[model samples]
Target: MQAYKQSLKHETFSYLPQMTPEQVRRQIAYALAQGWNPAVEHTERGTPAKESYWYMWKLPMFGEQSVDAVLAEIEACHREFPNHMVRFVAYDNYAQSQGLTFVVYR
Candidate 1:
């Protein structure tokens, strides 16, 4: 008999304990300090491999200095899509690519 292996999807900050609201705010603040734009995205299925499409909350908040605004947007997204997985993304304009991302709500 062959041994069974279970595969689990892994993401950034997955190993850490569930983040509190304050922790999330700190992350957003870090992104802003790094000069990265903050954005919110959600996926119904919440499977990054299978669910290739993720809907953006509104738009990438570029040049945003207010961590409160970013946190508010994250909360709003979660409220609107309670069933979906909400994620926080840090986009780097200079690199023209995503810098960091983590599932904020699952």
Candidate 2:
């Protein structure tokens, strides 16, 4: 199933714990190609929350790709950033817009 819903809006971002800063940026770009929004470090996390979380913007069809259908492609992209927690979301896009942000993780 797709990681995101067609009518819901979601956003997610995070700092790569096991990845280089450049790797993080590349990962986000891969996500966008597959339909996802990547954000930079927490803009409001001056300190720390219960569990450090990154802010992000999500589209309606961020991850609607099917496993049996898109697994190959997804896996190929996943190679860009290994050993890292990935944040993904899908939102509804009524205007058919392709806006995305690929923020590098530190």
Candidate 3:
């Protein structure tokens, strides 16, 4: 029998259907409504888990109230790092932890 091999993709939401732009907008709205700070990050394609720390696109967008603003940043990151995997992360200050995270570009 041939050996089974797992796919290298281990990013969050990788198994789910790729999110449409509208879905992503909704998710960003939800995070904003919850008062979570949005942040953009990017990692090189096929980056190993041992070097999983993605580079931040910029400072976390604290007090951001518009979903479009967050989406714009994601797009900017994608434009700058067209070949990298871009991700969206929401930080919950009340809980002092990450609340939502998903790859937005790959």
Candidate 4:
């Protein structure tokens, strides 16, 4: 008989390099132009949960057309969870699914 064990480490995969504020804003702008709504999430650094299962800090909401609002939320998340990993998620309302996801902080 063969046995297999699944690992639950959050660091199993290397994500894209951490992004800067300008880069994040640019990405958000592009997503918004494409009719995607921005969202944010974060997870504790040493948690056993997979990255995909991280807790959401904010949910996607439409009618947010200002880049400053998105940037402010990103900055707020960074301040509130300095030792955790933070991410940006864009949801496509028309497609009814996530359009893009990126890590903005490590």
lDDT of each: 0.83, 0.36, 0.86, 0.73
TM-score of each: 0.83, 0.27, 0.88, 0.76
Candidates sorted by lDDT, descending order? 3, 1, 4, 2
Best by lDDT: 3
lDDT of 2 by residue, 1-81 (tens): 546432222233332244464564454456555554322222231333412454432223334444322233333334544
Tell how far residue 76 is off in model 1, in angstroms. Answer: 0.8
Task: Itemize residue pairs with steric clashes in candidate 3.
Answer: none
- For residue 96, give model 4's deviation from the true position in Å: 1.2
Tell me which of candidates 3 and 4 scores higher on TM-score: 3
In model 3, where do residues sit more than 4 Å from their true spots? Answer: 1-8
* Model 4 alpha-carbon miss at residue 50, Å: 4.4
Clashes of each: 0, 5, 0, 0
Ranked by lDDT, the better of candidates 2 and 4 is 4
User: Which pairs of residues collide in candidate 2?
Assistant: 2-63, 3-63, 59-91, 60-91, 60-92
